[model samples]
Target: MGFADELFDLTGKVVLVTGGSKGLGREMAFGAARCGADIVIASRNHDACAEVAREIEAETGRKAMPYSVHIGRWDQLPGLVDAVYERFGRLDVLINNAGMSPLYDSLESVSEKLFDSVMNLNMKGPFRLSVLVGERMAAAGGGSIVNVSSTGSIRPNAGILPYAMAKSALNTMTEGLAKAYGPTVRVNTLMSGPFDTSAHDWEPESLAEGVRPHALQRIGTPSEIIGSVLYLISDASSYTTMATLRVDGGIP
Candidate 1:
């Protein structure tokens, strides 16, 4: 391998990615495998996860496991962690990327259930999984944790209030975890801006208008997320921790 390639190499490393079935999570999972890591793709949809797993294995010649569980369900997280260790022996990287923001017409329209759902999935679940895996990672030597946050956190609008709040808390969690398990384990936030994911069904005209305010005047493609993710998880970022790296198409 070349000097630059050695820095980003993931040979023999294992990675666990929540929401790895599709969108940016899927892209990251594939990216990691291309760098030589075995992957565990966890998501609510077993079939979706399985498909992605198969594709990753076929394309990258790396081991890929598909596990299904709702990220919002706190009780289910431990089993997921156990299964990964049983399968891969060690987890070198974890990307807390599962999240949702259901549409609500008004602030008053947001119910307790809806708010709780958002919080549980976006913040609560990641915290539990991080503590569980991070402790193990520290004990086993070291690992890296990447919390997939949002530009929404820093640029909160009424439409995405609940999600923004949860991501804001996630940012704080990333910093605290870095300190808690550092000198060994690294923790950081991948703060993302608007991207064209399967989540949106935008026509060209609307898509162009949506990104007008961004400095780049364009939405990011899912593949654009790979470089930043690779940096955080690999040896390339050995001295970095508790940092929020933005790959947000210069969103302003």
Candidate 2:
């Protein structure tokens, strides 16, 4: 491998990414696979995960396993971890990428179920899974964990107040986990802004308007997120942990 490629190589690593069936999670899974990492792509959609897994293996020659999972349900998480460790025998990287932000008429009108659902999916699930996997990672030597946060965490919008709140907490947990499981395990947050997922039915004009305030003046593409993903999961960020890399296209 060339020097640059060698820096981000994940030849024997096994990575688990929640919400890996589509969008940013899909992109990260492909990036990790391309860098030679075995992948466990988990999401609510089994068929979608399987398709991505096939793509990963065909493009990278790395094993990609698709597992159906609803990350919000706490009861389902233990099995997810067990399945991965049992299959891969080891997990070197974890990306908590599953999230939900439901629209509500007002924060006061948000239903209890909706609020809890957002929190459970975005915060509680990641917390429990990280504790389970991170402890193992520490015992086994070392590993990396990436929490995907949203710009709404800091730039809260009324439409997604609950989701933003959960993400804000996630950002805090990212740093705290780094301290709690550091020296051997690196924990960080990817504070992502907006990205244009082609799968979305969003109109091009509306998408452009949304990116007007960003310094780059354009929404991000999925490929743009891979650099930071690769860096955090590989030796390139050896000295970096407990940090937030805002890949937000400069939301100025």
Candidate 3:
């Protein structure tokens, strides 16, 4: 095979994507499947996960499993991992794509409850999942981890203090895991800008306005994010780790 053709192949790989029911998670799950990876879709919604899994299987002719778990609850992660291992035999990739963004007026206005919820899901959840999966990857000799972050983490947005803070912590966790896991496992964060996904609760008009200043002059679609995700998960990024790949359309 040509170098480029060989580099992106994911045959025989098993990938688990959190928040895989909708939005970018769904897109990434399908992308991995298209590249020849069996996928496990994990989210809090069982029906949604099943639906996405069916779609992936139909489109890619690959095995897709639906798993329901609240990633924010670290206690539930072990069982989820076990389920993946039991079903797939091994896991080769982990995509921490699950997150939440709640609107808060200001830093002071942020409630303790909101802060905890954001941190638990956005930061702590990914960290816990990585740790659990990283062990398996290390034992298997190697794997890849993709953490989903946001531009708000890099360029703080006013009503999103809690969300940004959690994502910021997630970025740091990505770096730390990359180093700690080392030559065995590669870890990276994808700092995303505005992307139109079904998971987002924002209205279309407001979401579009949010990304008008981006270099692309438009918000991204789920398809736009899939290429970057595929690159990170596939052999194309074999030597890459402890990196943050920004897919923000040049937004500062």
Best TM-score among the predictions, by candidate number: 1
lDDT of 1 at 165: 100
* Clash count for each candidate, listed in order shown: 0, 0, 0
lDDT of 2 by residue, 39-122 (tens): 999999999999999999999999999999999888899999999999989999999999978667887899899999999999
Tens-digit per-residue lDDT, 1-252, candidate 1: 999789999999999999999999999999999999999999999999999999999999999999999998999999999999999899999999999988999999999999999999999999999999999999999999999999999999999999999999999999999999998999999999987898877799988897888889998999999999999999999999999999888888
What are the TM-scores, per candidate, against the unseen true structure? 0.98, 0.96, 0.94
**Candidate 3, pairs of clashing residues:** none
Order by TM-score, highest first: 1, 2, 3
Clash pairs detected, candidate 2? none
Overlapping backbone residue pairs in candidate 3 total: 0
Write candidate 3's Cα lDDT for 1-252 as tens digits: 778667888989999999999989988999889889999999999999999999988989999999999999989999999999999899999999999987767778888898898899999999999999999899899999999999889898677878898999989999899988988899999999887676566676876787677778777878899899999999899888999999988896
For model 2, where is the 10-residue window of minimal lDDT?
Answer: 195-204
Error of 3 at 10 (Å): 0.7
Cα lDDT, all candidates: 0.96, 0.92, 0.91
Query: Candidate 2, TM-score vs. the true structure?
Result: 0.96
Best of the candidates, lDDT: 1
Better of 1 and 3 by lDDT: 1
After superposition of all CA atoms, the RMSD between model 3 and the true structure is: 1.7
| TM match of model 1 to true structure | 0.98
